[model samples]
Target: MAKYNKVVLAYSGGLDTSIIIPWLKENYGCEVICVAGNVGQDAELDGLEERALKTGASKLYIEDIQDEFVNDFVFPTLKAGAKYENYLLGTSFARPPIAKRIVEIAKKEGADAICHGCTGKGNDQVRFELTIKALAPEMPIIAPWRTWELKSRDEEIDYAIAHDVPIKITRETNYSKDMNLWHLSHEGLDLEDPANEPQYAKEGFLEMGVAPEQAPDKPTYITLSFEKGIPVALDGEKMDGVTMIKTLNKLGGENGIGLLDIVENRLVGMKSRGVYETPGGTILYHAHEVLETICLDKMTQHYKQKLALEFADLVYNGQWYTPLREAMSAFVDKTQETVTGEVKLKLYKGNIINAGVTSPYTLYDEEVATFGEDEVYNQADSAGFINLFGLPIKVKALLDQKREQK
Candidate 1:
């Protein structure tokens, strides 16, 4: 008896997904429809349809969700300033939109169940399944890694070889990697051991950018314009969101601007070490932060900073579809109304330096802030303000002094 009449698998044509097409067919005895959401993993999609069909998929639907990804997922999170333990939530937020698209395709195809190649122990499983559950509550999810006998990547490779499923990676060079327009992450292999340093100089290890040491000696300056917290232009030229990111990626990568090495706590309750290259994303984050400093008021900015922490946790835990995330996004959107600005940055090796920033809504009053002869600010009023502010401290100290004297 077949468990499902048809299954829509979230296919990336990676090593795990390449073999899954055959595995699903063999085990479920059902037609497999593959859905590959294109969130700007450029060359990774090359010949993906052919590979999926060759491995026994009924058909492949490649959805181009890049613009939606940037506008909906990336920008919203950027506005929130969400960073999961300094990890820009690159892979975290990318999952929701991809999974949402998968659900759409599954409904369109009338597939009885949805499938994904995410492993049992990783965060991606939770991310994919959560989105699926949120969107289509009744639909079943087939996670082969949880049920199948293939215990390791080595076994998966062997299974791929035995099944004649074409895979791009070999055993010697098999590193678990996830790439998109925002970033490229490297894990597994030497990276699994926290004590071992990543081999950035290795020929195939880095795809997005060079090692910081390999970057040019000179600094590169560029201007970025933002409207309502979303990047709108690069180097004084108006550009679409996609073009702006791509251009920044090229420039940031060449200058070695964004390389992160961290041992992060995964949602599955285990610590994982990975090296992430997010040249363009890093640049954007820095520039946006610079713009907000002059634009946002002190209290609102401080409150948003606290909110950003919770926002990061939600995104990292695959709670993108939850009400809390939606509410926080609404709050973030409200804060971004005055975030329109231009930021000038100098990119040096593995560093982003703010050259200048300006906004029509800037609250920085030089007359009030200047140390020398500021006419706008009333210096005499600070005496009353300070006395009022320090009254609680003075009362507490007086009580303590009386207790000591007694």
Candidate 2:
């Protein structure tokens, strides 16, 4: 009656997943191998190994992938200027690398199936399952939410208590949260009702930063440099992906730079309301856009803008490992060839203000564009150019005049 001899479960020491360990063993009669990927969840990862094994997991694998996450996934998504409904693709894109590692560990541990704690109503279930399907199609997926008898979080709590499984969440104060290096998203509870304003003043409401009103009075200024659209340095100091993001997180969080409260359309044919705190990501996105204005050609910039919409959708829909995403990334990489520049920005109370930008690839020429009479440009040439440019409009107007006379 057991479907899998061993299952590799994508384990986070959270309420839902904690109980899932016991549920899987009871229902499936299989050994559960827990794998927790570290994508910069900070305090969320503390004592996860002990918790996994303590709660019926045969073994636990804690993999450090923060550097790879920022360098490979976050930077590329940033370069594409991809935003899922004007918010950073933080949680959306973070799932792929996590899922990728789960497949790897599953193979290493000879797991016949991969499992996750994602609920049926949530997008994450699709994200994790789709990526698993892409990488290792034969490996079965065990989504407990879709199959289990636990109807609600309250039910889950009751089950956990019955099974003697330890968890931090309580029915009264449970708010669903997903955290990574780029962002921390808060949902469920009061957020379910769109009318209820998010309690920003509350301790757990925002994990990354303070409220905009509570930010310091003085604005913070910093310069960021990019090479091939990837952020390379912060404030004139060169840093690797992890350090740059970490440094920006502290600076941007202090200034309350990135926060968005949105009710977004989920792929599961539902609308979900959540507050996302993406301090560092917001800063990086602003800086990248500013640099792109100078570095990229007008046509390429316009096309890429359109492409960014598709890119954002793909990432949001868990198509990160698909051929379309790969092709789009190639196009994005080619466009970034000239996207090397320095952008200065002012961060003040949740606002990212552009101070200045300079790039070797800037197409703007002072000699040609200056209002002060330029020797390099002949002003009289514009008369003929405008006449030719407006010829179609002029002909159309004449035709309309003749029709009116008739």
Candidate 3:
């Protein structure tokens, strides 16, 4: 067997990772250093450090990466208006940054291999491994679910019980969850069968939004201030990206703002149903669109929409380190140069109503758009413009008619 002197495991303090510490010790006889990343998994990090240490980890690295996540990863996607099939790519973009941090810590600690608790069938294993391949291709990746004898979640639970590793999961609430600043996604459980409807009443399952019934009767007003395409404030208060999202998430969640249920195609070629809570992200996307209406020109906005889709795919597929993503970022950054403005929104019962938008660089001219009269745009000029624009379509239709007559 190839020997590993030490290994850095992407530890979440979850059931799988809780057991992996002992499993690695017993099987490979290698010292395990646990690394737990904060990607907006709020309560998931509570007691994580203590638990990892108690579970026989030689060392632990707890990294607070929320700001970097929102600014570096989340904002760029928001700028692109990228959502994977109407559901925001919340968990999709979080993998690369976490992997980058892991590689950094591994090198500092001189670990021989990096390990993760991700399963063989899941998309995360691919996300985690691909990031490592892109960043540190030389390091060995120790995937327990792929190599170990533990096959089922039940068996893993049994191992946890026998080993006395502290865990929060149970058969009733065994749904797999991944939460972060962007959104919270829930899978497994009854979600495995597409026919079964999710039981929303379950505790610790959907923590982000209020049960639609519990929401307030009145609508809430929110104002987002943007400077060069990045959100700089909420309701006129200057704040960082992390704080802005946190504040909006509270308001949006209270109003039952962001809740998406969809069956999406994974990168590994399988359809999966996920219940997502993206309170702040939903607000941000809407506000960004409102600002873009006033800020971006017609040609730039339309072309960037296509670019945004490609950028979203790259982030979802764990291709964050590639040159194309950087190139896309450059293009997005240029479009956002004039994306400075404020968007007023009315949040009412899970609906976001765009109130008004104002920007110094606005292209909307009242004189040109007025129905009664206009100075800049002559109505007679459109006859020539339409003739040129429709020439190709007219030619195609004429040819089709001629062919039908024949």
Candidate 3 structure quality by residue, lDDT tens digits, 1-406: 5789899999999888999999999988999999988987888889888899888999889999988888888898888888878888888888888988999999999999999999887778888888999889999999989899999888999999998898988977787888888888889878888787766545556788885656899999989999988999988899999998888999999888888888988888989898899999999999999899889889999999888778878878888888999998999999999999999999988899999999988888877778876567778999999999999999999999999999
Q: Write the per-residue lDDT of candidate 1 for residues 75-178, one digit (tens) a residue.
A: 89998999999999889989999999999988988899999999988999999989999999999988889999999999999999999999999888888999
* Off by more than 4 A, model 2: none
Name the lDDT value of residue 157 in candidate 1. 91
Q: What ranking emerges by lDDT with the best candidate at the front?
A: 1, 2, 3
Q: Residue 233 of candidate 2: its Cα lDDT?
A: 94
Clashing pairs in 1: none
Q: Pick the candidate with the highest TM-score.
A: 1
The candidates, ranked best first by TM-score, are 1, 2, 3
Model 3 earns a TM-score of: 0.96
Between candidates 1 and 2, the TM-score winner: 1
The 10 consecutive residues of candidate 1 with the worst lDDT sum are 200-209
How many clashing pairs does model 1 include?
0
Per-residue alpha-carbon lDDT of model 2 for 1-406, expressed as tens digits?
4477898899999998999998889888899999999999999889898888889999999889998888778988999999989979889988999999999999998898899999999889988988999999998888889888889999989998998888887887888898998999988988999999888877856778888998999999999999999989998999999989989999999998889999999999989998899999999999999999888888999999999999999999999898999999999999999999899999999899999999988987888889897789888899999999999999999999999999
Give per-model TM-scores: 0.98, 0.97, 0.96
